[model samples]
Target: MENSPEIATDAASLRPAGVSAVALSRLASATGGQLLHVPQNADPDEIAISGVSIDSRSVRSGDLYAALPGARFHGADFTRSAREAGAAAVLTDPAGAQILGSDPGLPVVVTPDPRSQVGAIARAVYDSQPEDGSGLSLFAVTGTNGKTTTTYFTNSILRALGETTGLIGTIEILAGGQRIPSRLTTPEAPTVHALLSVMRESGMTAASMEVSSHAIAFHRVDGIRYDVAGFTNLTQDHLDLHGTMEAYFGVKAQLFTPERTQRAVIAVADDDDEWGIRMARHARAQLGAENVDVFAMRGGVVADREEDPDRRGADWTLRSMSRRGIGHRFELVHRDGRSLRVSTGLPGEFNVANAALAALMILASGVELETLQRVLDDDDPLTTDVPGRMQLIGTEPTAVVDFAHNPDALARALAAVDPPDGDGRVILVFGATGDRDRTKRPLMGEIAAREADVVIISDDDPHGEDPAAIREEVAAGARSLVEAGTARAVEVYEISPRAVAIRSAVQMAGPQDSVIVAGRGHETVQEIAGVDHPLDDRAELRAALDEMQEGRWERR
Candidate 1:
């Protein structure tokens, strides 16, 4: 809220995504940028911006193009293209100025750290703030996994309470009723402020978001203030970006700081990982005990599992669960001894934890327990189907689609959907994403082999990396278990063209067998050689099942 500003303007000045026209001098002053050049014919006060975009191709007329540094090349390399696309001004660092080639007569706001400062500039440009004079209640969830599910749960439940809510996560953005695909777990700072501005303009007063470790470290959420910040358990993920486990924990811990958040809702179900414990300690040190609440898994056989669910047995707990057809009716007991009973459409015990954590966030927001009980007591109840998180596709073979992309997620998902003794077989069909932390590839293989009777390794977002090579690494991990005789009945298969692998898994499923299609759950595209080929795991799985029902399904 530091750089937030107020300005009086009419409808003509309002631009796309709710960005308002602002003086060039004002943007420069807010960003502390050195104004390199101004057009000879244009006045600094008269120059106006409609929006901000990092991608050159998406740049629009009267937009401010932010050209930052990238892994392969300087984004400023596209300055001419942005200019051609009608960008009114450019924001970049000194390095980008060099790439922009001395003047060219366009106004350039040059800052030493553009990425860290853009969110503040964006907030000023768009006049993004709660219109009701009350600060917008922003909620966020962070962890290696379950973040998307938690965000959806939090947002959906809030909506059920008759609140206009915005949602941002790894999957998509729901600005009121408008939905858009997510490009990052947490978008760039400017994008965050812009989207918030859009939401406010669309009559939304609150928002739920997923904050990623990379986003925290990169300052993607630099200027936003969250009302409630929740934590799912940390695990082995994004090691490719953060480099080490400790470093990953360190960045994730930043979200709990009092500067970024007000009230905290942390899931402390994981008895193994101490990061959540350390996070609670850190948050209490800054925000004090009253503002921080740590909730952990208290009942159900879920807590006894090896997966660290990050429950601390502290302020609140979930007890007495009665599951009903891929759903559960549970009792949420708070530290103050008050309890609320609720039901969720979400399957898997881990989702019960997600819903409980979300309910605690609602409680922290001052919703009455009786009100929540009434909502849950409704004939329909409040439940959300998070795309690809235990999404069931068939009843005959009992197939499910999930976004369990990593080892811990794969393990927990397998455990959640595992069949009982003499019940049936658990067949897993999955692959690892390319250009990610290679360490998890083999670990994913290990989990599938150990948990499922049939393991089919395939492709997932190969990117620019070789598809065959990525498959081999995962297969090696699963095959290692077979060589060790630990997963004796485990049968492994290596397949390509993901559709083929999915079809094979479907055909192999017998009655009572559960076929899980992991990774790339809600994703609609598969990356290969820098191109996104059309593909959706859910769509493909459904197609495979439909074909099987028609007695025309075949696999090679």
Candidate 2:
């Protein structure tokens, strides 16, 4: 986009996909909202809301436009555009009502909490009631990280089992068989219900979705019950929004409750991360011991991958792991005598953890273990290339691309990228996203310094924040270790342009070293100021790696 009013922002892409034409009175009854400026010719109950849209530009005929209040502008400010776009009704709060000032003919639904009510109203409009084994078995996966990978794994497994599976997550939304890249980690309430409605209409048998902290905090998944809600460990992330780790975890914890989910799958691989343990206990209490299962990896990740064979209380165990080319194969033994032999092409230890959680969640959904194992045994298993999650683009210096933005994710990515020789270095090129969770910047710096041999701090998405300042804050955190002589052996670089950071990291790396380009995984655009600049980390990393290879050949 060109940073203009005419340019549809990436957010517009998150607008609900299907049309929702429910009676106006149904929406009012669903939200306990009162209709304002009711069209007299049309019965308040008879006026249909054909669709729901938060963005005025995308409003279609018979659509109900939600004028939600935000920190900057009340959604009502665009009421004129919504009306011009043929909106049937407007949903807004009292403040928005005041802004309208008796717009005589335009139908409106006045409610105090439009944001929270959006999902409920949307569910009513789209007729997307996910009853027991309705159109698809819904799976909700949430955590600070690994959400995307787990969703991918679960969806791939479902498809391999001959089920038409839909997937909604950070990477994209898959309905029927169509793939739509997502604008949010989780779409807004109306969009989510609308998408589910689409899948239900398409006769999808199962769908796996990534539920983010923002989704839970904002009730984005309201009115929809999940068959399985998977938690992939909690970590220090999004502190800027939640203010504390406790608050953040509280939001994630809601997804595991009986009211929100029917079953739960928690990864207990890293016993050190106690959050999973707590979530497991909570799920057992809420969903029953039979409804909950824990997975600990003893097999897939290489030597760096740790497994507690004597791990207590785990229902499923990856008993052993061995490498086959770039992939790892493991045997997953259930609490019962049943077992599943699994394999994946991805090399990261975190992928192993994600796959384990995905596998257990699939099992919880009632898929036969033998059938799932047959799917993993195919020449291609779980589709293993998850966009930009630890994707290997080169061999000489072992270039890898990952989406590790937060401190916890960054630390895990560093620890998982072990080179062949023990002395080989892990070179990381990553930066914290600007205008989001500033609290994580220093924490990320400290963690990177502790885990990585070389750190190149650069731009992720400046998004109106000063790019240089963001780098300085992260660099300052890492520099603290150097000043104390704790991380003097760790080399650090402060690069302005991210392209330079990626190339510099690759150039400085030798054959024994691994170069990891973190952040902005699978994203083709980088937001700076108000415009999105075309950029892909995977593409940049590949170009850099190729350039280095050509240079080496010329030198010979």
Candidate 3:
């Protein structure tokens, strides 16, 4: 229950400098909330509000403190602290208003649901989208795996096109070159608007953000609309929250609506399940066919499918891909016969999908094909490094760290790293997240057993669940496949404390073998039993390789 130091100081750092204040009454009226408890001498319209914050510890003077209801406690219980921290007023639900009782000594805006209104209020207070329409050209990507990489690619491409860009995603938030550590794939609504305002004030012209399903379900991106929204792919993950894959897809589908994005770019590559195709159809229905662009890898199952004529062609088709170093160089051919040759240094054919989606999104945002092609060919924006995303750490045994936590992602990562024309084995070290999608543990295990020569089940973010239990579930799946004689003779071992498992994987790898540390990619901390332990896969892999090299040198 300790207050976060970042939250305590966020008021000064996260809030944009010289933001134009909006009248308190205007926000209440805009959100259709009842305004009450204004000071006797103050007119509601004259009470200026400079910012918005959901966390009381981050409240600053002239900020509207959004006191929402939580599962355990009502946020209005912290209103006194928010007031002491110089909050101007309170925005809360009726229950929160009741928690404050009467005469709370500040103006209160009461609504039935405050969580849904936080984004709108923050937007108006920060003027994130200026009335003059000179705001950041917002781009958002949402899906299971490639959201982070696609956004990074989008930001890089935007920069390549001579635009000052900002980024909001899993690793960090870059606002006009100022880097801030990120805690979520998409942060809370207030922080989202505040970051956008910072980008605008710092003269950034475009910003790319990763929008997670949790963000959409929780209304984190309530009011802000993107110039272009991209979907990478949907897979079996986050079932703990959404309960069903259908429901999960429903939440991702929300981002492509006309209200959330001006244009939609959907990737339908290898769409055997047809989620991508369904998403494209939904987007086109909602935003009109002109505003929706479908992208596919030319030889993918979906692109080659002859059953449905509607799924036959995409606006952009990735074709003629040839391996370039660890990654692939591919050509993005449009249905209109315009083609742009692009490449991503990041490994995996899926990254080719991510890079293609990024290019299509930029083009959908009104960037000319010639300009985009110039950036792709000349600047090679898609070749930029994305942390923890197929990030290669060593060359001798081919060590890699990736954030492929789900069954689909894990399968793809294994396929990408499998030794091509060698006796090299695929050594995988991975574990399911505690307290999330329990069903995926066995599926991931079975995949590891099937695809990898050696499987080391290690703890990811155990959270509150018992790490041993989580490992056993994954081991059960792997063991089932191995015992059933359906999979290759894979050696599966359960190793704890994660660091040891990583070292073990590295030690087992040979010069031609690949050691992949999957899950928790780009994440430096591992959360277990409400505590964070420092654990960077990249750093650990490098240290292990260094140790191996040092030992070899000594032996020689």
Candidate 4:
């Protein structure tokens, strides 16, 4: 017999593929969440899952319906719908527990706080409990603008270097060949761990994920221990959830806490980066964390003589960088006195920074600089394209779809595709999100008016926010430029329907011109008045451009 140490695995210890009813009870009990329903002597190894679903419409027969409570609607209200669709069981909060009485025949579990505990419960019930600390390396990137792109870049580079990888971001989750559509910026804790386990089983050695401030604040990433935590940058976003900018930053800062993380990769060019470094330093002193790495894109960069001067910064300095046609070339110099010149087919300086951040993160993972560089230069950066982050739609008169909803990101996008050195205008189409950071509306308008030649204020998921009011505020800010004589008279068109605005903008764009369909990037659905309408900016932009081209063809 082979002398192998017996790995203690139980019903609860079994992986998600082997989960049972007893597993669910223990998961709820561990989190101080109460379980209302229990089958006597239920087996804990009978897996009762295909996956978990929060929406009734998507709930399948084996799924656990997470009946969460929201301000606008109670998830319990959808319980009947979930059951009708064949959900195995319904999970709800203490308040929603009463809804279970309405349907006694349903297999219902009452949780103390469904939203907070669901992730933990999900992790406990599905995953083979992580043995203290062990298994695949996990890297999480968080920021307002670069989260999705940076994660995608890292995933691509890792895969290029021959490591099977898993990625979760704004675009999709790449687990093996499965491309799961992402429903949250950072999946709730249970789904996160479950996905990680699946990745590990699918032969992934590493996983790159995007973490959002909302996820942190809501304790969405509660149970998993991240090997490397990256801070891309921070700016005004999701203010409705955090209430203030300081609060938003506070939530983002929690990811770096000693209790939660081990290593960190922070971007120094952002003001939030300076604060993050400070927070990391404090956490290090308090918790004795060993690996804290920093990379600066510009401005705050500290170059050393030992490092190549042609580089942007000494510590993983970006150097010899140039844009050739539709691609970029740059050098990454590590602290150990090694440099590798890399080229990416992706355009824009922002992408260069994103690539640099990925390099630093890969370096932090103990991969050889040259090997990772070869992967980035040869395989990853060339083919990888983040869904909504600076995703260009057409040529001649170019149209791009970007998720630049805030002022800072909008400013960066404006700086990125600077009008192609021509007499044509940079037209913008965007609208502020409803019930979110109302303060940023005028700022977004101001940036658009200041940066672009023509501004088209349009709808961007005004979700109960008066579309006209949102557009009016943005237009008001844009019109301020003309009123102050700071700009060469800008046109502010109030196009309520987003598609109409996109069509209008694309038609107006000439050969030397560029049209930015801003705000909604990779999002496939647009939420309006509590309903998600199917929408894809990239597809719409493409169709609109094709229409414009067809019209031009007819005119000719």
Candidate 5:
């Protein structure tokens, strides 16, 4: 198993150029903290903080180091290191303050809980968000899946409309002309504020971000309110951290509150899943009915519900969809009979939902319908490449690489790649991530068995679990389905050293077959136990196809 790239901890490296400083006294007052160890002759209000950082090692000159308490060691243990790194002041909780003993040789801001105030401190120091609503127009998306693609679609449309845009998501962070690979679905609160400040400093007009459930639960997105927030559907995943699906939903719902966003666009496409409908209702209750918009892609129960006026039909609908090349052409129809014709070259029906959410989110952010329509027709921004998202590598064997790590995503990917008219079979290569929701492992395997013709159970960041054991758990589900003989005939294989599995899948595939390498989409490193190994699914798949082509040339 390979480990994720370490987050860039050097605050100076990530901070925006020429950011104005903020007074330490003002920050303490804003966060309801008390200033301790202020110099006898020095005024606390005159002490300037140029930046904020939670990690001691990331501290820079004129920075306020937030010494927070963690599960194991308190951040105060590194106060000497932070001071050595040129941190001008410190912000810590009561426990951390005690850990520092007396006269820690720096100005200290003591709060009951410093972690919750990190965002506010960073925002104030960086001036990331303006009070008069004058800076970047912020947009955010959250859900089990599609958040990345939706945010990408949103940024692309913003660019098409002639606005320089920034993006913060699972894959990377884009601040106007600057690009940084991301280590987390949502980075720490300080990094979020720093990137936004950078975008603003660069004269970017708008920004889109992915709000993971973990981010909200950990207060990673605090102190910033979005112009619009969109919700993709929720499903089983992340049980290890959240403990339950309901808990996960609650964390996601936090982003829809009036304090967090000015408006919301929610996808309620599935009638069987009430999570979307419930989310819409929650947003409406929090932000008021006028601020929330319900979007339906297939006109499900949400479109027909008339029992309660509050639970009424969809505000926006995606209809009149038809196949357009490998993608689809669809109409986004408003309840008032207004509509916009849009299309996405992306490979899945779920992508249609993603594009729709993006469009509606822009509309919710006050973009005119005509403007969006013209941009859609002229630029077709929705067709832009979202890396590793149903990414096509080859046409002959229909080779694709996708970040579908869960049951819902795996099933959707399989359905999208399965041939509709030809005899080509679906060849799937996938594995469940270790140290995650173990319950989903069998579910994902069953999905692959039912949807694909050949199932290759492989390794995906095994972390600390036994790789063979993880494969067996997944293989058990496929083997059970095969033994029961309840589904179509399927061939299953358990393979290791993921690269070889890619080659084996390609070797067994015919020209008409579709080969999908799911999970760890854009991730280049595969973590085994505690070490990170160099591996990229797209590179391996491409290499295998090139080898096969070379073999044919040699035969000739």
Candidate 6:
């Protein structure tokens, strides 16, 4: 967290150390942009910002604020605040350029397509060279679920193999033995290069990154070359942004492009996995520079034969797996018939899939299977905990907090749980996020109703969307299950106060019941209509569970 005071107030003040105006102009020229304010020969030493910002509040004094037109509002509206806050210059598309006025004679850079140029401009400013030259092996794991877990476990396995590792995921940044809060699952273009640069400078030999579909589509990871790429599984999620499941899957598939990665590893668990595998293979065959490696958790079935579903077994078979105090121990069976008993403190079957994906990446990176076996046995799995991912909150009533906001994720989470010891029911308290993939709201409801004995639908950052509307969607879906007789009558409740929801669920939960709180897993803040409200689901769930214990004692 060590930082210089000069750049403390304005991130713009931290212009990449050695950039020059000539270089900036060259970069501008490449993007067909015009430098409106500063002289072409202006000393680059004084240039502070590497890119532009749309939000003025986030703009540092040295930032190049961008006055772009957004669907909701014009970035130009924030130009005055940006300048007052110490913006060195402003960047805007020509349309915005005509509307925005600046005080303090702030410099303005005009381009026709400011948004398109942002990534390229940031790359030039940061001087992002290919990652291979850094002598560090960079791996990117992408999918609908398990991205964070795979990245986290990949870090662990890499560490076990004697390599210093860095990670960027939903939980936090695992860097320099410190946990830094993450602003985004995948940060913007400049920030990504900046973080990687820091990792390289720190002498890390390997780094594992969770690449979100949005990040790939937006060119956030534009400048980096991944040594290896891993896929977990794809499912229904993020439809709000991508518009359709196919489009969503297409974005995730962007990671396996041969030009972006050297080696590809795929997990064939879902129907859409074939698209990823086909794309990777096509990339290798067409590009000829990258190599493709396919992996299946299902055993003995040839890669092509597993397509039949009935014949396909897992590339790695797990058995005799017993849950022990928030962790699970199982034996991983490889295709060669050699099995390794792995005692991973990580919970859930999804985690085992994540571990298998991580292990595959390690093997793909040239780590021997024998070394991976020893690491799985001796190296503790609990050490690399992925936050909010089937994260166990308490043993009593067995409360778990997860980031499963969609039907697929919810199904996996429900399946992962050991279904209360005897007659205990799995009680789920969750709701769909507002303004996102509304279609999945009821699907999630049906999932909860069909899989869980009790369902509690609550708030999940309605963000400009009516909370009631969201709740109704979920209710409707759950109602579908009841009407269809797919499940027994579901117990549904609308609890606006999440803390109260957790408390109510805990109060009713018995020793045999499993309480699951999903959606907004590791998110510390609840975002609504672009405003963030402080609300950590994990903390709230734990606090409620602790109070429930006290209440039981008091009743005794």
The estimated TM-scores of all candidates read 0.89, 0.90, 0.94, 0.81, 0.95, 0.83
- Predicted candidate 5 versus true structure: per-residue lDDT over 364-436, tens digit per residue: 9999999999999999999988888999999779999999999999999999998879579899999989888
> Per-residue alpha-carbon lDDT of model 2 for 1-556, expressed as tens digits?
1011132234334333455467888778788888879856778777878778888887877888999988899899999998988998899999999998886358888888988888887777776764444646899899888999889888778777877777788887776445677888888877787778777777677888899999888878887888888988788888878999888877888888888888888886545557776776677777777788877664332132223322336777776788756667778787666888777778766777788888888888887777777777873445456898988888768888999998878887887786756768888888989889888899888887887888889999989899999999999899898778887236888986898888888888888788899888899999999999889999998988888878853311
Compute the lDDT for candidate 4.
0.71
RMSD of each: 5.8, 5.2, 3.8, 7.1, 3.5, 4.8
By lDDT, is 1 or 6 better? 1
By lDDT, is 2 or 4 better? 2
Candidate 2 — number of clashing residue pairs?
A: 4
| Cand. 1 TM to true fold | 0.89
Candidate order by decreasing TM-score: 5, 3, 2, 1, 6, 4
Top candidate (lDDT) = 5
Quantify all predictions' global Cα lDDT against the true fold.
Answer: 0.79, 0.79, 0.87, 0.71, 0.88, 0.70
Q: For every model in order, what is the number of clashing pairs?
A: 10, 4, 0, 4, 7, 16
Tens digits of per-residue lDDT, candidate 3, 176-285, equal: 44666788888899888988998888788999999999999998999898999999999999998999989999999999887899999999865464898888888877
lDDT for each residue of candidate 6 in 1-556, tens digit (9 for 90 to 100): 2221111222222233443322444655676777766755675445666444557876765556767778888787778898887777777887777776433266677887676666666555555454247546888998888898888888878877788887777666654344566767887665665566556566667888889988887777876678888887777788778988778877777777765787776766443456544544544453342254445544333434343333333344555767765566766665557766666677676776777777777777777778888777787743476789888888767889999988889888886664645467788889888877878888888888888887888888888988888898898888888788897436777788676777778877876678888988889888767888898888987887788777653311
What are the per-residue Cα lDDT tens digits for candidate 1 across 357-387? 8888887888888887676676333476788
Name the regions of candidate 5 deviating beyond 4 angstroms: 1-12, 300-309, 552-556
Superposition TM-score, candidate 6 onto the true structure: 0.83
By lDDT, the better pick of 2 and 6 is 2
**Ten contiguous residues minimizing lDDT sum, candidate 1:** 1-10
